[model samples]
Structures are given as C-alpha cells and as structure tokens.
Target: MDKLGNDELATILKWVQDPHDRKSLSLVCKRWCKIEGFNKVSLRIFEPNSLHKFLPRFPNLLKFESSETISDTQMIFLAKTCPKIQRLNLKFDTFDASNDFGDHGLFALSKGCSNLRSVILRKRRGIRDGGVASLAKFLKNLVNLDLGFCKMITDEALETIGKMGSLRSLNLQGCCLISDLGLSFLANGILGKSLVYLVLAECDRISDVGVMELMNLRCLEELNVAECGPKVTDIGGKAIAAMESLKRLNLSWLINVSDDTVFALAEISKNLVSLDLTGCEMITGDGIRAFASHKCLCEIVLTSVNKFNANDLEELVFGCKSLEFVRVDARLRSWIPVTEQGNIFRPNCWISWRL
Candidate 1:
C-alpha cells in the first residue's frame, strides 16, 4: 500500500462504492485520508459553526447541505473552501427566526460558486430580493430553485428570475407578496421558454388575472395552484386547461371552480395523468363524472369534495380504463354494497377512503 502512488490510490478508492469501506481505507494512513478527502464530492454538515476547522479537507466538493442555523461568515468560508459546489440545500425549519444568514452570504456564494445548478432556500426568511438578484446575475446555469415560504420575496425578485434562461423548476409557495404583475413577468420572458414546473400553493395574493397570464408557458408540464385563494375561478381554470403540455395539475381548495372547469380539463388536457380537486366544494357528481372517458388520467383525488356520490365514483372507476388510483371521502363506504365494491375492485385500481 505504501508503494502505490496518489493516482493509483484514487483509482482504487473510486471502485470502493461502500461508504463504510471508504472510511476504513481512509484510516489506514495519513496519506490515504488526504487522498480520500480530495476525491470527496458531497458533504452534509450538522454543525455549521465548526465548518472552518475541517472544510478545507474537501476542496473538490460538488454538493453541500445543512439544516442547522448557519451564519453569513460560515457561508462565506464554505464558498471560499468549496468553489466547485453545484447543488446547495439549506432548508431549515420555518420557526427559526435568526437573521445571521442573509443577502451578504448569498452574494458571496453566488459570486464564488458560479457552477450552481440547484439551490433550495426554503423557509429562509433572511433571503430577500437582493440575494435572488445576485443568483440571477451570477448563476447562469441554475436549473431548479425552491424559494418556498420566503415571505420577503416580491415582484422585484421575480423580475430577475424571469431573465434566467436555464431555470426549469421554481417553487414560490407561501410567498404572499407576489401578485398579477409578477406572474406576467414570468409568462413573458426567457423563463417561459425554460420553466416546466411551477408551484404557487398558499400564495393568496395571486388571483385569476395572474393565472391567466401563465397560458404563455407552452413547455409547462406540471402546475400547482392549490389553496391560492378564491379569486381563481373557472376563468383561471379554463386557461390552465388550454395548456397542452400539462401532465400533473393540483387545483385543490379553489372553491369557485365548478363543473365547467372540470369538463374543460377532461376534454382539452389530453395528457393529464394526475388531477387533485380536494376541497373544491362547487364541483358536483356530474363534474366528477366528466373524466370517465379520459384516456390518460390515472389518478384522481376528491377527498373533502362532498358534492359527489358513490355511484359517480363507481362510474368513474368502471368507465376510465386507465384509472389506477382514486381517493374519496370515507362516508361513501355505506353507499355501495360489499359485492358491488368487489366488482369495482376487478379493475386494477385502488380506492382510498379518507375521513
């Protein structure tokens, strides 16, 4: 082992896929430990304050994650230590109100690590528009960004995100400040051409006017506008139905949407595979029956939707040959007989009875 060169050691280490075996090999000698650190590509730190003590050992790291409360100084140290990082996950619990990590740290990371492709800053209250602007300015190849529950982010942050041509998936769930104007920015520019997945759940400020603007996103595949307030009626729902590339859609709790929207989705959204209409009280049994002949729909969720009956569900299960999963209220168990339920189970579909 002492006769083998550094290159030979690295080659042998690459074949040792088991992490335990790799750790054992590193303990053999000081030189083996150094070689293992050089080849390391990913690291997750539980205590970020002690980052400077041992971070330099892994200079070739490509991915980094931390859920602990991190400070700006520590983040800067991490950026300077691992410049090759491509994915950064800093998601922490929403209850942490510390202002230690903010735009200064984000700017340093974005400037130092230009190769970042995926960055998840969910529930980071310190991160405002300035940090997001820095990302748009520096990280040209960034693909997936999750800014969920970042209450400080407004239309100004979205304006910068609109110019990110390489970004594909974006989550703005719980961002209450963004309105119709921000949605318009996302619909018009390079973002429309690149983005395929978008989540706007719990963003109460966005209404039908904002949703109508998203019709320009021709490449969009999955969209979630669940619990986005009552302003999103059949008008917005109809606009969503017009998008041909959509496969998965979540419109849960949009109480204003009636049978018109359901019928439209059943007729137009030819590739839709999953549909969630949970808590949509306006839609009746007729609306639930609209997707009976849908060729591509395989999963449907109707929990808390009291307007539909067991007969409507039976029709949907029997008529839709591609149906595989159906979720409905537990109250329907008494409506159908045991023999009839057995007949309904003949097809390769599972029914989830939820209370």
Candidate 2:
C-alpha cells in the first residue's frame, strides 16, 4: 500500500483509539508534519509554554474550548490552523482586564474562517474594544455571538460588530461594564436590522431607555432579560410586546412587572410561542389569562410566581392548543388532564379540583 496520504492520515487520526498512536503517526516524517490539519483538543494551559507546544497540533478543529492564559502567538496559530472553525469558546477568569486577544489574531481568524458561525467569549478579560473591532472587520457572515461577561468592551466594539448584518442571535449577559451607551451603538448600528434572539441577563445597569432602542428589531423573535434594569417592569414588557414578530420571551426575575405587563402583552404579541415569567410575583390569575389568549403560545415556565392559581393556569392550557411544557410550584391545583410526554406522572404535586 502506498504510504498513507495526508487526507487519509487526517481521517485515521480522528478514529485512532490512543493519543500516543496519533502522535506516533504525526511524527512519521516531514510530509506528515505538513498535513495542514490537527486533532489535539482540550482545555489545558501551563502558564506560558503549554500553548507553544500544543498550538500547532490541530489546524482544522471544529470546536475549541480554551480557558487559562491566551497569548497572541497562540491566537495566531489557532486562527491560521483552524481556518474553518465553527465554534470557539474563550473565557478569561482574571480581573486584570488586560487586552489578551489583540487585533492581529482577531483579524486573522475573522479573515481566515469561511464556515465560522457561533463564537462565545464568556468572562473574557483579555478581549477589549480594540480586539473586537479588528475581529468584526472580517466576520461578515456571522450568525451567533455571545459576549457575556466581557467587561472591557465599549460602544466602539459593538459598532464594529454591527457591520455583520446576518447576525441572528446575541448574548450580552453579565457585561456590567457596558452601559446603554454601548447598547445604543449596537441597536442603531446593526442589531435592529437582523437580530432575532437576544439575551441581556444580569446586565443590571441597563434601563428601559436602552431597551427602547431595541424595539426597532423588525424580525426579533426571542428575548431574555432575567436580571436587568428597573425599567424592565410593565413599561418595558409593554415595549417588548409591541414587537409583532416576538415568539419567545423570558422575564424571570423582574421585580417591578405587575398585571399590567400581562394585560399589555396579551394584545400585542399574538404570535408568542414560549414565555418565562419565573419570578414575576405581582401577576396573579389575570396575567396568566392574558398569556392564555395567545393562540400560538406553546411552552410556559412560571417558576416562583405566587399569585397565579390553578384556574388561571387551566384556562391558559385550554386556550392554547400548542402548549406542551408547563413548570409551576408545589402550591397550585392539579392539572385537568395529566399528561407527561413519554413519561408517567408518578407524583402528584397539586390539589385536585373539579370546578
């Protein structure tokens, strides 16, 4: 048999049972060294030298989860090696807020990756406004981006991201450093044009004023604001309800939202598919009734709402034919027709009522 070609080696390396066997093949010759692909993937970083050793091992990896110290050279190696990488997760745990991923690595990866899609940078203290600005310069076909807990980013970075009009999903959770000023930049720049799924959980400083800007998203579908501003009360709920295309909504821990939110939302978003009112305590039976009126409402999660009784929930189930998932507390009345998809309801959590 002719010596295994690089393509064949790449295929065999994926299925090889032992890591030593894979490395043994990789060290076969210079031809194997230049295979233009890699297989080693894990979340290990030994201060400064582990990256130097493992950076060039896998050039065409699909998924990368990195946590420890990230250097500029390692960033370049990964970007150039894994040109078509689809998912990348980069998180930094330090509070130093140093710009770790510089513009050079970001720009290179953005330009090199053709099939790139989902990118998440959670708690990344190394990525700042300048690094992101360069990254967005090349990522024009991006779909999902999560900048959760990236505290050093500013409005200018968001402005760069706005250039990608094809973006559908975005998560800005835990970025307490960015104010509505940055959000204002995002809303006015590109998010309003193409965004569908948005998550702004735990971004406390943002008030309704920032949300007011997002109302412009014509194709917006899902929104999650589990912990944010004082404005996320009925007023903001009403603002979100104004969007006709909204399908899924999460207002789990909003303190100020009352029955008014339910009343307002009942009329505006007729196409709602799923809803999460987990901790909105002020809403009683009336709020649930409002949600019941939605014809397309499917899954509902009301985990900690104190006011809603069983009658209201039953009415909601009766109103929507599409409802499949329901989560409530232990105090409410039992459901009408006990049905658990594929599983038996062994334990009864509510009182039985027939009126």
Candidate 3:
C-alpha cells in the first residue's frame, strides 16, 4: 500500500469519510498520513493548537470550519496557508465575548482567500461591519453568506452583502438590529434576482415593506420569516404568495396571519412540499382545508393550532393522498393506526411529540 502511486493512494483515502476513521488511517503509517493529507479537501478544527501542524499537511484545502476559540493570528495564518479556500465557517455555538478574533483576521482572509464563495460566521460576537465590508469588496464570487445569530452585524453589513451579485443563499436569522432598510438594499441590488433561499427569522424590525422586496427574488425556493411578529402581517403573506418557485416556507409564530393569508399561500405555492404553521393561532381549519389541493405537499406542522379538531384532521387526511407526514395536536384525541385505503402513511412515517 505504501508503494502505491498518488492516484491509487487517493482512491483508497476517498473511501474513508468519517474524520475519526481518517485519523486512525493516518496514524497507521507515514505514507498513509501523507496520502490522507493529499486527499482531504475539507476539515473541521476543534482545537486551535492543531492549526499549524495540520494546515501544512493539506495544501489543497478548499473548506475550513472552526467552532473552537481561535484568535485573529490563527485566522490570518489559515488564510496565508490556504489561499485557494472557498468556504470558511467560524461559528461558535457557545459565545465568548472576550474572543479577540475580529476585523483584522477577516481582512487578512478577504485579501488572501479571494475565491471565497461561502462564509458562515454565526455567533461570532467580535465580527462587525468592518470585517464584512472587506469581504463584500474582495469576495465578488460569494454565493452563500450565513451571518445567523451574529448579534454584532447591523444594516451596514447587509449593505455590503447586497453588492455581491452572485449570492444565492443568504441567512440573516437573529440579526435583531437589521431593519426593512437593510432588506431594501438587497431587493434593489443585483442579488434580488439571484438569491434562491432567504432566512429572516426573528428579525422583528422587518415588516411588509421588507418582505415585499423579496418578491423580486423570482428564483427563491425556501423562505423563513418565522417569529417576526407585530410587523409582518397578511401583506407579507401576499408578497410571499407571488413567489411561484417557493417550495418550503415557515410562518410559525406569526400571530397575525389568519386563514386568509394561509389560504392564499396554499393556493399560490402549487409545488409546496413542507409547511409549518406552528403557533399561528389565527389560522382556522378553513385554511388547512385549502392544502388538500396542494399536489406535492408531503409534510405539514400545525402545532398549537386552536381551531382544528379531530374531524378536521380526518378530512385533511382523506383529501390529501400525497401527505406522508402530518403533525398536529396529538393530545386532542386518541391516535390509532388507520388502515384506510390501505395505509395512510408511507413505510418511513414517523411521529415526533413536541411535549
């Protein structure tokens, strides 16, 4: 095995997908370590100390992820080493405000990794507008940008993102400071025509005006505006209804959305597959009834819905034959396996209880 050519060694390494297994393989021999390094294109670093040791091994790395505590110096080192990197994710699930990685590190990355197309910086508290501005200026090829849970980002960061004309997936979820003004920048820019997936969940400042801007994204396939209350209303629903390409939508916790908006969404999105109306108290059985006409709908979640009872759900089951999964108030009545036409569920049907 050690005497094999690079192509043969790469073929053997490609069979090992799990990181732990790959590490075990690398430890077998020096030749195996070199083969593993040459074959690897993506890596997730859990320890900051391994940066210098591992980076040199994988010279052709394209994607890098680090959820551990990493400083600006380490980030700069990564960029300097992997100039061909296309994706960089530096999300920290447990935020530490004292982390020193900030604009300086990101600036270095933007300068060195010019081919960067996807960047996910979720929960990186130190990152702000200045760091992102550099990316917008240099990373013209960016396609997917996820800044979810980045409390530091505001309208200024969004302004820079709008200029990235090639962007297709944008996730700004939990960026509380961003208002309709930020969305307007995107809607009016070149990204409006290119973006396919947009997530604005918990951006409460955005209203119907901001949502209306999304109508210009004709290629949009998935939209999540969940929990954007008091501002997002039926007007936003109207705008969403106009997007014919939308397949999956989450309107959960939008208290103002009633049967009217729900019905309109059901009628318009003919190809809709998954719909979540969780905590949408205003929607009645009438709106859910309209979903029966949906030819492709497979999954429906109606948790905490007030109006629908046992009988209404039965009607829905009978009407929509394509439905493979349905989640409702299971506590309302006894749920017995129905042997209706033959089986109301597919072989893989599963029931998940919220409580």
Candidate 4:
C-alpha cells in the first residue's frame, strides 16, 4: 500500500462505501489513517462532545450529520473547520436537555457556511421564525431544506423561505402552525418556479385554497399532503393532476378523497411513477382500476382500502407491466390467487401484505 500515492489510495478508498470497512482500513497503518481522514468528505456523529475532535479530522467534509443536539459552540466549530460544507443535517434528541442548539447556533452556521446547498433540522423546538430568517439572509445557494417536526415555526417563517430562490425541495411535515396563507407565500414567492418537491404532510390547517395556489408551480415533481384536513378534496385533486411534471403523489389519510379524484390523477398524471392512497376510505376499486393503463407506475400502497377485491388487483397487475411493489391490507392476502402468490417472489414485482 505504501507504493501507492495518496491520490491513488484515496481513489481506492472511494470504493469502500461501508463505514465499518473504512474504519478498519484506516487502522491498517498511520499513513492510511491520515489519508482516510484527509480524504473523508462525509461524516455522521452521535456524540456532541466529540465534535471538536472529529471536525478537525475531516477538513474536506461536504456532508455532515450530528445525531445529537449540537450546541452553539459546536456549530461554530463545525462551520469554521468545514467551510466547504454543502449539506448539513442537524437533529435534536428531545429527551436530552443539554442538546440545546437554538437560533444562535443557526446564525453562526449561516454566517460561516454561505455555500451550504441543503439542510435538515428535525424536531428542534428552539428554532422559530427568527432562525429561518437568519438562514434566508445567507445560504443563497441552498437547494433543499427540511424542517420536519419543528413545532415552533409559524407562517411568518415561510415568508423568509419564499425568498430562497434556489430552493428545490422543502419539507414542513408536522409544522402545525403553518396555515393556507403561509402556503400562498411559497406559491407566489420567488422560489415557486424552482421548487419541485414539497411535503406538507399533517399540516392540518392547509385546505384546498392553499393547495390551489400550488397549481402555478409547473415544475413540481413530487407532493405529499397526507393526513390533511377534509377541505382537500376533488378540487385540489384536479389541480394536482394538472401538474404535468408530477411523478410521485401521496394522498394518504385524506378522508374526503373519492373516486373522481383518483380517476383525475390516473388520466392526467401519465408520467407518475409512485402513488400512496393508504387510508383513503372513500376511494373504491373503480378509482384504483384507472391506474391499470399507467405505463410508468411502479409502486403503490393501498393499505386499509375497502373497495378493491382480488379480481380488481389481478386485473391491475395484468395491465401495469411496470408495477414493482404493492402494499395492501393483510386481510386481502387470501383474496389473491395461489398462482399469483407464486409470482410474488419474481424479480420484477412483489406484494407486501401486512396488518
């Protein structure tokens, strides 16, 4: 190994995708350890106190994830050490009191990491609109941002997010405070043209009025409004279908969705590849059967569906050659034919039936 140059050794190490294997290789010799540490571009750590030690080791880190609550000091350390960071995922352990990294840490990070392209901040109660505003002030190159389960955020923060013109993906799952007006800000904001993927799952306050605004986002490819309020019905569904670029749609737990909405989706979204209709009590076999002709559809989840019988499923599989996986209610397992059950183990397609 000593005969190989550092660049060549690093190139060889690139093939070692498994972290454990890489760790073992690093222990082989002092030179290998130094090369491995120097070449490492991604790192994830669960311990908060060890941030200083690890931050200096990976000078070229482009992606970093701190599983624990990273404090303000540690965030500053990370930003200073890894100035070239492109993606950062900061998660807070709610049970741990000491993991208090609030807006101050976020401000420090935003000030130092101007080139950050993507960021995920999950379950951080300390973050509010102020932190989001801080992020918008800098991080102009950011492409994706996830604030899932950040309960403290309000609609005011979205106004700042709308200013992020480069953002392509945004997730506000479980952000209960966001209303229809906040969504309007995103739709009319500068980022609307660039935004392609959006997740509004469990944002119960959002209704058809808010969703209708999103119809203007022609570039939208994926959307998830699962578990939303009853106000999201056929009107919003039709609007969603009009998004020609949409490929993946999740309408799970939408109690008001019916056959008309499903048919609209099947007719309009020809390029759609994946769909989740789980817990849609109002959708029947007639609605789902419309998907039989969808050429690009690969995966579907129909858990707790009441309308689709064994025959409907059989016909669906026979028509959609691209169908790869189907997740259905366990009770329907016995409804499928024994011959088709044998096909479950086939390379091309399979079924997952569970409680």
Candidate 5:
C-alpha cells in the first residue's frame, strides 16, 4: 500500500461501493483520508450545523443533500467550499421555526454554484420569488427544479423561469399563489420548448384558463393536475387531450369532467400509458368503456368513480390488450364472478380493489 501512488489508490477506491468500507479506508492514514476526501463526489449532511468544520475536506463534491434546517451561514459556506456541486437537495419534511435560511443564502449559493443542474427545495417556506429569480438567472444549465409546497412564490417567479431555455422539468405542486397568468408565462417562452414533465397538483387557484395555456408546451410528456379543484372541467380535460406527447396524466378528483373528455383522450392521446381518474364522479360506464379501443393505455386508476359497472370493466379488460393494472372501488369485487376475476389476472392484468 505504501508503494501505490495517489492515482492507483483512487482507482481502487472507485470499486469500494460500501460506505462502511470507504470509511474504514479513510481511517487507514492521513494520506488515505486526504485522498478519500478529494475523491468524494456525493455527501448527505445529517447535521448541517457542523458543515463548516467538515465540508472543507470535500472541495470537488458534485452532489449534496440535507434534510435538516440548514442556516444561511452554513449554506453560504457550502456554496463557497463546493463550487462544483451539480445537484443539491434541501428538502425538509417539516417546517423550521427558526426561519434562519432565506433569499440571501439562496442568492449566495446561486452566485457561487453556477454549475447547478438539479435542485430540490420542496416544502421550503423561506424561499420566495427573489431566491427563485436569482436561481433562474445564475443557473443557466439547470434542468430540473422542484419548488413543491413553496407557497410564497407567485407569477413573478415563473416569469424568470419561463426564460430558462434549458429547464426540462418543473414541480409547482401546492403553489397556491400562482394563477393563470403564471401558466401563460411558462407556456409562451423558450422554456416551453424543453419542459416535458410538470406537476400542478393541489394548485387550486389554477382553472381552465391556466390549463388551456399548457397546450402550448408542445414537448410536455407527463402532467399532474390532480386535486386542482372543481374549476377544471371538460374544457381543461379536452385541452389536455390535445397534447399527443403525453404518456402519463393524473386527472384524479376532477369531478366535473364527463364522457366527452374521456372520449377525446381515448381517441387523441396515442401514447398515453398511465391515467388516474380517481374521484371523477361525473364519468360513467360509457366514459370508462371509451378507453377499450385505446392501444397504449396500460395502467388506469378509477377508484371512487362509482358510475362504471362490472360490465364496463369486463369490456375494458377484454378490449385493451396492453392493460396491465386497474384500480377500482372494493365494492365492485363481489359484482364480478370469481372465475372472471381469475381470467382477468391470468391474462397479465391485475386489479387493485381500494376500500
């Protein structure tokens, strides 16, 4: 081991996949520890308060994750120490009472870490429009951004994001402050050309007008507008059907959408693979059966949609050859015969009876 060079040691370290084994290697000697720190690319800081003490050891880190309530000072230190970081995850499951981290830290990080490609700030209350704007302005290579549950951001933040041509995925789930105008900004700019995945679930402020604007995103493949209030009716649903590139869609709890939207989706969306229509009380047996002729639909969720009977399910199971999974109300299990249920499962499709 004494004869081996730093390059050879790093090559051997590459094969050490186990964290415990890597920790043991780092303890062998000061030289080994220094080499290990230099080679470390990803790190998850359990105690962000002590970041300044240990972070300096890993200057070439590409990814950093912390679930703790990291303060502004710690974040600034990290940004300066690890300028090459490409992915950062600062998701907090619970809100912090201290509110020590905010836009100042975010601005500093964005200025220092210009190479950031993916950032997840889910459930962060401190991040407002100013921070987001700074991120959009500095991180030009950023592709995926998750601002879910960041309730303070409004249309102003989206206006900055709409200009980010390289951004491909955005999550605004639970951002109630954003309205139809924000959606229009995202739909009209260069960002529309690249964005393929978007989540707008629980954003109740958005209605048919906002949803209609999404049709301009020609490359969008997956969308989630579940639980977006009763304002989204057949008009919004029909607009979604226009996106031929859509592969997965969640229209759950959209109670106002009727058979027309279903028929449109069945006939228009050729690549649709997964669809969730749970709690869609307005859709009936005819609406459910419309998907029988669809070629690419494989997974569907109809739990709580009581209008469809067992006969409609039977036709759907028999007609759609690509179907592999179906979720329905538990009450429907007794309506279908045991032999038919067995037959349904035998043909590579499984049913999930939800209570």
Candidate 6:
C-alpha cells in the first residue's frame, strides 16, 4: 500500500480510521493535507472554508455526496480545489437560488473537474440552460448525469449534453424546457460511440423525432421516455426497434402508443426484460400479444385507461413466466409465480436491469 500511486494512495484514505479523525488529519500536516483523499473526506457538514481546505488535498477523488447544507460559494470552492473529481452528487437544500442554478457554482466545478463521470443535481432549483452548456464545456468524461426536476434547463442544455461524446446515461426527467430540436445533437453524429441508458420522462416537449435520432447510438441499452406528452408517437417506437442493444423501454403515461410500436419492439429486441406502457390508452390486446413475444420480460406495467381486452391479459399472464412486478391502474401486484419451479425472477433480480 505504501508503494501505491498518488491516485491509489488517495483512495486508501477512505478506509482509514474514523470520519472525525480523517478531518483532523487533513489539518495535521502539509504532506497529509495534499494526500489525494478528498473523496474519502466524509462530510457531516460543509462550509466554504472547510470544504476549500479539504478538497485540494485529494487528486483521486471520484464521488462527493453532501447530505448536509452546502452553499453555492462552498460548492465552487470545493470544485476549484478538486480537479480530477469524477462523480459530483450535490443533494443540498441551499445549492440553488430562488429560481435556478445559473452556472456560477456549477461552472466553477466543471471547469476544475474535467474528469467527472456522473453528476446528480437533484431538487436544486433556479438552474437554467446556460449552466448545462457550462457543464458540457468542462466535464468531458461524464457517463451518467441527472438534473431531475430542474425547471430552468432548456433544449439548449440537451443539445450541449448530446454533443459531449462520453455521455452514456442521462436523466432529464421533469425538465420542461427540452424539445425535439435537441435531437440534432444526438443524430447520426455520435452513432459509433457507446451510450447505454437515457431518460427523458415528462419532458412534455420531446417527441418521436428525438427518440428516432437517439436510435443511431447502436450501443444504447435502455430508454425511458415515459410521461412525455402527445409529442411521442409510433415513429419513435420504430427507431427504438433498430437499436439492437435496447433491452428495456419505459413509455408509461405516454397515452399515445399503439400496436405498431409493440410489433416493432417484438421484431427487434428479443432481449427485453422490462416494458412499461401504462396510461397508454391507444394500446390494445394486439399490442400486449406483440409484447408477450419478448420471452425475457420480467417486469411489466400496464396502468390507467382501457386499452387491452381479456385475451391479451390471458396470454400475458401465461407467457411472462419471469414477471416479478406488474402494475395495473396504479395498483401494485406481484405476478411471478411462487411455485418451487425455479424461483421466478430469472437470473439477476437485484441488479438494475437497464431503464
């Protein structure tokens, strides 16, 4: 362990002694202060100076999750100090202003933390599209990034994000500013790269054209366009079918999908394990039958509004032997047969399948 690289040594700090002791150690000596252990420095509280003092010491830090209160000033301080930071998880109450996160703090972090892999800015308000552009400008190594419930971000942010080549998994659910225009960034441009998971649930503005553009990423594995408004149609479904790596799709509450989408899915991705078409009123028994052909499906949700008939239900009941959870009209039901015939959940039940 003593012969490890500076990167490796910093990682070892997480396993050292108590949390309080770790904090004290950073202040003990200049050698210890510069010891690549920023990520290991657990935080019960984060103030501007303390974070500023703690961050520069570690160069190998990967993830930082702040459970306590953190101000924008402190966030910028921390980001400025940590250049190699990979995953930044800021779930603080004070991270945003009254209406948005306007790239001040985020810009500082992205500028310094060029190696960022995943970032989750959950529930922080007042962030706009410009901040997204800032993120794309700096954090080039992002794999998974989520800006959930941020009202100010627009399609411009999406465009910037799509242009970043390293992006694999992205979640922009409830971001009301996005529209189909962002697809121009995700079009045939980055098709050769590997983008596995993408979620645009409840964007309201994004439609089939965006989904169609996304299909070009041949390595894409899962997609969740659930709760999107009437903008999404079967055209998106056809595009999804062409993605060979797609194993799961969530179109819940879309309310527009019909049999055509299901048929395309059935013909292409035979490896599907989870399919949610809940609240899709246009779906019928034929669609369900088409979905049933996905023998690997284990979790299915068909909720709200009338679409399918009795025959479809019966076939679905008989076919999906691997089903573990099924939702119907907001009600949760466990459908996996509990027989001794090999405990139903197929292979890996606990692992996050895809979407």
Choose the strongest candidate by lDDT. Answer: 1
> TM-score per candidate, in order?
0.97, 0.79, 0.88, 0.86, 0.97, 0.75
> Which lDDT values do the candidates have, in the order given?
0.92, 0.71, 0.83, 0.87, 0.92, 0.69
Pairs with steric clashes in candidate 4: none
Give candidate 1 misplaced runs (Cα > 4 Å): none
Question: Among all windows of ten consecutive residues in candidate 6, which has the lowest summed lDDT?
Answer: 346-355
lDDT-based ranking: 1, 5, 4, 3, 2, 6
Alpha-carbon RMSD to native, per candidate = 1.2, 5.3, 3.3, 3.6, 1.3, 5.8
Per-residue lDDT tens digits for candidate 6, residues 50-133, read: 765545555455667764545567767677666666777865465445433347777877887787888888666656777788
**Could you tell me the TM-score of candidate 2?**
0.79
Residue ranges of candidate 3 with Cα displaced over 4 Å? 1-35, 334-354
Please write out the lDDT profile of model 1 over residues 169-254, one tens digit for every residue. 99999999999899999888799998999999999999899999999988999999999998999999999999999999999999
Steric overlap count per candidate: 0, 3, 0, 0, 0, 6
lDDT of 6: 0.69
Judge candidate 2 against the unseen true structure and give its global Cα lDDT, from 0 to 1: 0.71
lDDT of 3 at 292: 73
Across 57-135, the per-residue lDDT of candidate 4 in tens digits comes to 7888899887677788888888888888899987655635355778888898888888899999988777889999989
lDDT accuracy of residue 42 in candidate 5: 96
Point out where model 5 deviates above 4 Å. Answer: 343-346
